[model samples]
Target: MTVALMWEARAVTGRGEELLAWARAQELTPGPMRRETFRAPQDRVLVITWWDADYDAVLPELPDPGGELVSRAAHRWRFEPVPDPT
Candidate 1:
């Protein structure tokens, strides 16, 4: 099974681009099978990483860019794909 890790953060006012750049520069240790990033309207950045591991596995996450870049602490979540019935 594969697991997906999601990390999200909201940048401080007028600092969205800086935060996005910081997130884009991060390299996950051990790496992941796939990864992508997205931006929302309100200076929010979201990153999703896919890994060939179990849900309980310890995975490398994006570290804090800096206190000045983000408005608050980052949020993280782990998920496993639902099996197909076919």
Candidate 2:
């Protein structure tokens, strides 16, 4: 099964771009199969990574971008896709 890891953060006022850039530059060990990033209003950045692993497998997460770039700690979640029936 493949698992999707979602990481998100809300940057401090006027630091959205910096936070986004920092997120974009991160390198995860044992890299995922694919990754996508998004920006939302209220200075939010979201990153989704797809990995070829079981839902309960441990995976590397994005590191903190530091207090200077964000208002609070980041948030993360893991998801496994529903099985396909044919």
Candidate 3:
């Protein structure tokens, strides 16, 4: 089923840029078909996600056992097609 991944993470100040760079650099493998980021009033979240070629098709590429100061919060939402708004 077509779906989207929503992930949020927090790190020390300056870590945001570092994380973003790392994420972009991961294109050496099963890279993200696309990704984006946003900032909130009181939180910094890294929104790493991509198109679903079968959500499970990319599970193995995920980090196993997390990383130092790199925590993750992920949720999946299925797509709901809508008629053209034209």
Candidate 4:
């Protein structure tokens, strides 16, 4: 099965660039099949990683950038793609 992990964070005021750089620099051991990063209006950063594994399989995820770097704890979610009816 394929699993996609989503991680999102809001950086502290004025530190969006730093946070973005930090997130981009992170590396996951064994890594994912694909990974992407994004930013949004409230200085928020988002990362998504695709992996080949079971829904409940343990996988590497990005760690928090700590209180100083963000406004609060980062958010994470997992998903499995649904086949399109065509």
Instruction: List TM-score per model, in order.
Output: 0.94, 0.93, 0.46, 0.97
Candidate 2 per-residue C-alpha lDDT over 15-75 given as tens digits, one digit per residue, 9 for 90 to 100: 8999999999999998999999999998999999999999999899898789989999999
lDDT of 4 by residue, 1-86 (tens): 99999999999999999999999999999999999999998899999999999999999999999799999999999999999999
Q: Using alpha carbons, what is the TM-score of model 3?
A: 0.46
- Sorted on TM-score, best first, the list reads 4, 1, 2, 3
lDDT at 8 for candidate 1?
Answer: 97
lDDT by residue (tens digit), candidate 3, 10-86? 54455666555554444425545656655443234445556646645554233322355444443334332356898
- lDDT pick, better of 2 and 4: 4
Record all residue pairs in model 2 with backbone atoms less than 3 Å apart, i.e. clashing.
none
Comparison by TM-score, 1 against 4, better one = 4
> In terms of TM-score, which candidate is strongest?
4
Give the whole-model CA lDDT for all candidates, comma-separated. Answer: 0.92, 0.94, 0.48, 0.96
Residue 22 CA error for candidate 3 (Å)? 2.3
Which candidate would rank higher by TM-score, 2 or 4?
4
Find the 10 residues in a row with the least total lDDT in model 3: 57-66
Candidate 3 overall Cα lDDT vs. reference? 0.48
| Cα distance off (Å), candidate 4, residue 10 | 0.2
Q: Give candidate 1's whole-model lDDT.
A: 0.92
- For candidate 4, the 10 contiguous residues with the lowest summed lDDT are 60-69
